[model samples]
Target chain A: MTSKWFLKSTGTAAALSSLVLFLYANLRQPTLTEQMLPVHLKIFELDRTPQAHEQQAVLAVLKQQLGVTAVSFSQEGKTFSVTYCPDKITAEKLRAAASLNEAFKVSEKTFPPSPACPVPPLDEVKHKVLGVLRIF
Target chain B: MRKFVLYFVLALAVGMSLTACNDDKVLYEIDPNSLYSRLGGFDAISAVTDQFLANVAADNVINARFAATVANPARLQLLRNNLVDQICEAAGGPCRYKGLNMRAAHTGMNITEQEFNALVADLVAALNRFNVPEKEKNELLGILGPMKPDIVGR
Candidate 1:
C-alpha cells in the first residue's frame, strides 16, 4: 500500500512538473534574434535624390527581390539607404535593381553601418530570469 | 536532471529554429498596388521629371518663367528637387515637399493661365514619355489639378 502511494505521488509530481515546463516554454515570447543577426545596408545616389515616385519604385523592386527591411532617402543629399537581411538577398542584387533608372539617375553608393538595436530593458531581463528560476 | 536538460536543449533548438524561420519569412513585403509602386517609385519619378524639365526648358512661353533657373545650374537643380518633392508628396508617395508654398512661390511671378496650361501639357507629355499607366497618370493629374488656383496668375 505504501509503495503504491509513493509511486502515485511520484507520478503526480512528474506530471505537474511536465505541465509547468510545457506551459512556461510555450507561453513565453520568443526572444528576438535581430540583435545577433547582421543587417545589410546599401546606399544609392542619384544626380539628385530622385522624387518620391522614383524612390518608391526602387524600394518596391528591392523589397520584392531582396526582401529589404527598410529604405531611407536623403533628398538634399540625393542618396538612399536600403536595409535588408543578407541571408535572403545580396547587395549586388540591390545595386542591379536600383540601376534600372526608369525615373531618375541611380548609382550605388557606400553607406555607414546598420543602426544597432537599443539595449534590452533590464526589468524585462530580470523578470525573465526570475521566471526561469521558478521553473527550476 | 539529465532528462530535463535534454528536454530543455531540444526545446531551445526548436524555439530558435521556429523564430529564425519566421524572422526571414516576414522580413519585408512591399504592397504591390500602391500608386508609388505602380509609378515605379523614385526612379520613374526622376526620369519623368528630368524629361519634363527638358520639355519646360524648350517651351518658349514658360521657358522665360524659368530663365533665372536656366542661367544658374544650382538653382535649376534645386528647382528639380522641389518639383519632384512636390509631385511625390501630392501623389501620396513617401516624400516631404520642403519648398516654398505655391502661393508664396508664385506670388510675384504673375504666372498666366496659358503658361499654367502649357506646364500641364508638358507634364502630360513627360508622363506619356515614360508610359505611366493611364489610371496613374490621370490620378497624378487630378492631384496636381487642385494646385492650379494656388499656382496660376499668382
Candidate 2:
C-alpha cells in the first residue's frame, strides 16, 4: 500500500509536468529583436529649406516614398525627421528620394555628441537585455 | 478760388490713400518658389555635398583643416551631415539645424579666415561641378556667406 501511494503520486506529478511543459513550449512569447522594432529615426537636413507652400510640397514627396513611415518638420522648418523601416530602404536612397523636386539640398544632419549625457546607438541593447527575461 | 483749392486738396488725399494700398503687396505676398526647388531639391543637394567633400579631400588648402575628420570615417560622415544641415537650414529650407551654433562650435577650433575662405571655395567648386546656375548658386552662397562671421573665429 505504501509503495502504491508513492507510485501514484509520482505518476500524477509526471503527468502535470508534461502538460505544463507542452503549454509552455507551444505558447511562450517570441523573442524581441531590433529588426522587429519600428524604433529607428533619422533626421535629414534640406538645404534651401522650403517655405510654407514648398514645405507642403516637400512633405508630400517624402510621405510618398516607399519606406518612410513618418515625416515631421522642425519648428524652424529647415530640418525634417523621418521614421523608416531600415529593412525596406537605405538612408542614401531615402536622401536621394528627398531631393526629387530639385530642392536646393538634401543631407543627413548629425547631432553633436553630448559629453554630459551619452546615448546608446541602437535598440539592440534593450532587445538583448529584455530577450533573456522569460516570465513563464 | 477757395472752392478750387478745396477740390484739389480732396483729390490729393484720395491719391495718397490709393498709394498707401500698393505697399501691402510687399508684406503679404508669399513666394511659392524656393531656391531649394530651383537647385533640384535633395538630389542636387546631396550631389553637391559629395562633390564638396571630394573637393575638400583633394584640396590641400582646406584638407588639413579636416584632417581629423578624414582620418575617421564616422567623424567624416558626421562633418558631412553637419555641413549639409547648415546648407539646408540656411537657405530657408524645412530643417531646423540641431547642431551647435557656428560660433559656439568653432569657439575653440580657432578656424582662420583663410581656412574659411578655402572651405567656401571648395564648396563653390562642388556647386559649379554640378553646373548650378549663377542665380541659384549666388542665392545659396549669399544665404550661407554671412555665416562666415560665426565660423571664422571664436
Candidate 3:
C-alpha cells in the first residue's frame, strides 16, 4: 500500500511538472496577433501635375512621426490622391499637422476599411479605359 | 517491482533531459527576407501589384479614382516600381524606395477609408493569386496594413 501511494504521488508530481513546463514555454513565445496592426491613410484631390516638393516634405515629416509606409498617389489634372500607413498616429494628429503646414490641405474625409482582396472587374480590357478615367 | 520502479525513474530522467535540451531552441523563427524571396522577388511583386491595380480599376466605388491616375502605362510602371520598392523594403529585402510621401501625394484627391479598404482587399487577392502562405502573407500585410491611417484620411 505504501509503494502504491508513492507511485501515485510520483505521477501527480510529474503531471504538475509537465503543466508548469508547458505554461513556461508558452509564456516565452509571443503570438503574432499580439503585435500592433498597421493603419492606412489616404490623401486625395491634390495637385498632381506640378509635383509639389514642399508637400512631399510635409509628408516626410508625417511619415517619420507616425511610422507610415506604403504610400500611393494618383493625379487627375490638378487633383492628387495619396495613401499611406499611419503607424500609431491618430487622425486628429495628422489633421493638426497638415493644418499647421500651408503646403498641404486635408480634405473632408473619413477612414475606410480595407478590402480583403483586390477588385477584379477593372482589369478586363473592356473596362480598363473607363476604370482609369474614374479614379482621377 | 523494484526493477520496474528503477526503469520508470530512468525513463523520467531521460524525458526531462530531452525536454531541457529542446528548451534552448525556438520552434519557429521565420526569416523576413527569405519570405520575400519566396514570393517571387520583384517580378512577382510587380505582377501582384498589376493585378491589384487592375482590380482597383474595376471596383465601382473607387474605379474612377484609380483610372484617372494609373491610366498611362508609363505612369503605371512608375507606380509599380515605387510600390514594389516599398513592399520589398518593408519585407526586409534589399530595396530603396524613392516615392513621394503618402499625404502630400494624396492631398486633395479625397480618398475615403472605404476606398482604401477596397484597395487592400484587392491586394490580398493578388497575394492569394500568387499563393503566398498565410503566415508570410500576414507578415507582408502587417507591413502594409499600417498604411491605412495614412491612406484613409479621416
Best by lDDT: 1
**After superposition on all CA atoms, what RMSD does each candidate show versus the true structure?**
18.0, 26.2, 17.9
* Least accurate 10 contiguous residues by lDDT in model 3 chain A: A30-39
lDDT value, residue B119 of candidate 1: 87
Please give the range of 10 consecutive residues that has the lowest summed lDDT in model 1 chain A. A111-120
Model 2 chain B: weakest 10-residue lDDT segment is B22-31
Task: Please tell me the interface RMSD, in Å, for model 3.
Answer: 15.3
Local error of candidate 2 at residue B90 (angstroms): 2.2
State residue A43's C-alpha deviation in candidate 1, in Å. Answer: 33
Q: Which lDDT values do the candidates have, in the order given?
A: 0.60, 0.58, 0.52
The alpha-carbon lDDT assigned to residue A104 of candidate 2 equals 51
Interface RMSD of each: 18.2, 26.5, 15.3
DockQ of each: 0.02, 0.01, 0.02
lDDT of 3 by residue, B1-154 (tens): 7855765566566545544533111343435557557786656765566556544543456756645244343344345556766786676555556566665556555678887787788788768866888888898888788776666663
lDDT of 3 at B85: 64
The TM-scores of chain A alone, one per candidate, are 0.47, 0.59, 0.38
